[model samples]
Target: MRKSMPEQNTVPTSHEVGSFFRQSETSLFAIILICGGLLAGLAFLDSGQHGLSLVGLGVALGITFMGFQYGFASGWRRFLQIGDGSAVSLHFILAALCALVFIPVTASGLGPSGSLAPVSVSLFVGAFIFGVGMQLANGCGSGVLFSFGGGSGRMIVALPFFVMGSVIGSVILPTFLTFGSLDPIEIGASLDLSGKLGLNLLLLLGAAGLFFWLGRRQGFGLTKRMLGATILIAVLCWAVFMVSRHPWGVTFGFTLWGAKIANLIGLPIEQTTFWNWPGPQRALTHSVLSDTSSLMDFAMIVGAGLWASLSGAFGKADWPDGAQLFAAAIGGLLMGIGARLGFGCNIGAFLAGTASGSMHGWIWFVMAMAGSVLGIRLRARFGF
Candidate 1:
């Protein structure tokens, strides 16, 4: 029999904290230490080969920092419960921190190579669908991976379905593209920053002010632990933006896993973009999204999940009933399709978009929230 909530709380004294840590998904501090050290070592060894691509360096920093931030957030549940606004406040603080760093870097137009690529309307539409999918799944792509790591049995089922959906999505993406749903955002035309620092300065100040004002209005105060976590995540976000050549992503893992699974099953899955056929051998070839760094993302989620599960921070399995299961499956499918269509997920759209100053991010966020609300309503009505 499961212990009652009251019973569990009353019997906690000597080994409570230790036990909780043990049950948590993964040790953020440990991940920070390990990953940070690895990246640092790489930076040390290849000072000449790669100048520690600031964006890549930033991403590494962001991942570890976010682990700490989430750890702190989850630890202070009592404080967080004090006000719903508290969560908003923390996001504001984190967002502001990210915007300040990322905006300036992008505006500066300094990087290893590659000209600036514009954010597009397609990105916005994709983002909106992605957001809606996150709410429906009751977690973002990254959240699902961690939830599974933390022993979320329901998420475990959802993950595979998510991959399948992505494969299906890849097959049908051509149709969507033909229908004109997948267009890119034009940056060069819309932006008016010509003078050296004109646009960059405006964006930097705008991002900082916007997040700060939002935070103030939302009452973004924090306990020491949460403060520490926030700082860690802020730094990490900065690093990710500087490194990964794009943004922090979580769905790529699902995409790759899905591709691999399909190939194994002889389902004619793309060895590259999840849309092509693999004949004779399922040999993985070089594409922008399937390289070492892509695999690194896969490892991070698995690693984080492992850490969370061992720490006793794992939530209950809470398997969805038949109806809820159906919802979950469909939701996961939408998420996969939407994420691919948008070229990202919650982390990709909202988190990355907000940090990058793309207006599409904001649009996707609103639509996704709306979709989530609808999903919740549907779930409730059906008792799922």
Candidate 2:
């Protein structure tokens, strides 16, 4: 009787179980943030004296991740809603604001001028293909990084292929460039408006008008939080310009990574026309930490992961079906190639380009959107 009385219940109570889960989740979130901070710190140290700028970028991106998690409405979901023009239009507005702030401040001394790709048959072709690919893969360059950080399994599949595609694109880019293209067009350069009313004003006004129209059409208005986030991001972009002496960019890092891998595997990356250029060559030869764009990209992914974990947005990813997996791989390849041929992915070519007043940005946007429509249709066929 005394032995039987000594037997105690071993099952955890519901409250105990709940508390355990909460503690585990909190621990996981803390780990992610700590890791992100470490990565950012390493990137800053590796930035060689430009550590301040890297720090600025890391903090800004971290804030942006938090905003995406807490402020924005349906962050990733909005980007995929082709029928709703809000997300695209709002981003354009953000770019416009960045341009309005940085142009006068920088006095047009933005270095690394080669980031601006000229309009050409290859650009249209590549952008169109990229557009399709983004839709099929369900992520753009920035999108893929953030989605992966947010624990999306599909994006993980797309990432490697995207890198491979970028390498292939770099290999073939010289051929595409030989097809002939126009010189890069800078709006401020061609117009006398910068002297009188300021060209940035016109650009900002036009973007604002478009945003308003799109919002009305969609029966939505920018929330206070969203507006605040946009303003913050715009300022961050301006800071990036001030420090880096160039607008924000993303895909170049991918190309660099791809080329490096190719080089390591006995590929003649140095012989490629694109890599032969001074800037590209320097990036290819140097440590990745010294590459500003690459550092920012790395920070962005870590920041996204940290924020997603804190917000409970990071979760186990759903398994993809065979067809879906195939679509992701193919889409990633197309996106990689398209990004190189078109001069950038969505962030580089479209957002940064437009903000910097390059006509190619507008061209990339139109072509990519058109491609997106087709991509969406293709995605449906794959039951995505």
Candidate 3:
């Protein structure tokens, strides 16, 4: 989990933090840490168990993410480099399965909602930019969070800038909405649950078939590692949707974090057009602890870090060269801006949206893939 980087301060590195946490994880500290999150959430939020459930879900996601090392950026990179479609194919399957469950859940009116976003020029440009950034940073939204958990120095560097970019994006997003955007197009919205399920499944099958054909050379079979991880991760995601009444998401939490920080720094964020909206307005006024997505993000980082420590990922703490740090900064900034402009990263837009039967999810996937291709080429020029 440790990587080479240039030193800057006398402070103990995150590697040290990882090591300490790793050691503590086997002790009563682990239980306390988890309980702390649960208790805090329960106490702070009106949703009670539902909010605590999100905390638990976030920890589960972190553990699963690190354990399997399943990631969007790496998966796409491998597909582009070696023509392995296993990961790519598996994601589509995962989304399809989630859709099967989510469509019914939404219809049942149990409180769960889909990750729907408008179809706009911003969405197209943002997804593509996010793709490029993920490749440059070597992680997507989930990838960055878990990678940080696993004691990655480069990720630590990228994270703050990513936050900065998200804040900036949020400020500019309302303008993007003016650029030929269409209202969110929910697939089969007028249909019954059964109709939605069939239509969604049919569409998923078509997409999966296309992927399989395109990468048939290496085939689409997952390795034992990936298969096990996928099963566990998929189940966890389902549980999260059931409890949270929303599909899994990550980027919005970062954006919220940025927004909060901006408020602290005296930015007139609350007055901005985007923030003035009811949803953003509420978010701006609430504690981070009360926000489901933000809480999840926090838990995931802690979970990944403890896991990384156990894996001995913090044994070494080498600082990256200036060039590498510079690259990471640029990557983080782009990803942050892109995520906000695009409505989400892979997890939020592609996985959650598609699962919730939103057409924008499919659009995000196509554009992001194209962006990944460009990212790969840029990677060569940057000597990555």
Error of 3 at 126 (Å): 0.8
Cα lDDT tens digits for candidate 1, 237-302: 665555555566666556666666776789766543434445112324333223323444544554
Candidate 2: tens digits of C-alpha lDDT, residues 1-384: 455566775744445533454556667678767876676567656765585466557546754844464311133234447334455556766877877755555554445332366888789988999988888887788777777666666777888899899888888887987888899887667555375226655765576667567666767566677667777777777777777777777777777888888889998888878888899999998977678777777777767766666666544334466677788889889999999899888777887777766789889877987788788778888887
Worst 10 residues of 1 by lDDT: 71-80
What is candidate 1's CA lDDT for residue 80?
A: 28
Model 2 misses residue 271 by how many Å?
Answer: 2.4
Top model number, lDDT: 3
What TM-score would candidate 1 get against the native? 0.64
Return the candidate ranking by lDDT, descending: 3, 2, 1
Which parts of model 3 have CA positions greater than 4 angstroms off?
1-47, 316-319
| Model 1 stretches astray by more than 4 angstroms | 1-89, 107-128, 181-227, 271-293, 314-323, 382-384
RMSD values, in order shown: 8.2, 7.0, 5.1
State which candidate, 1 or 3, has the greater TM-score.
Answer: 3
For 1-384, candidate 3 gives per-residue lDDT tens digits of 999798787755556655565565455346636755664555346567667777777888887898788799988888888887777877887898788778887888778877788999999999999999898888999999998776677788889989998988898999988888999999998988888889998988677666666677776555677767877888888898877778888988898999998889898888899899987789889877677778889888867766665665555434455566677788899999999899999999999888888888999998998999988888765567
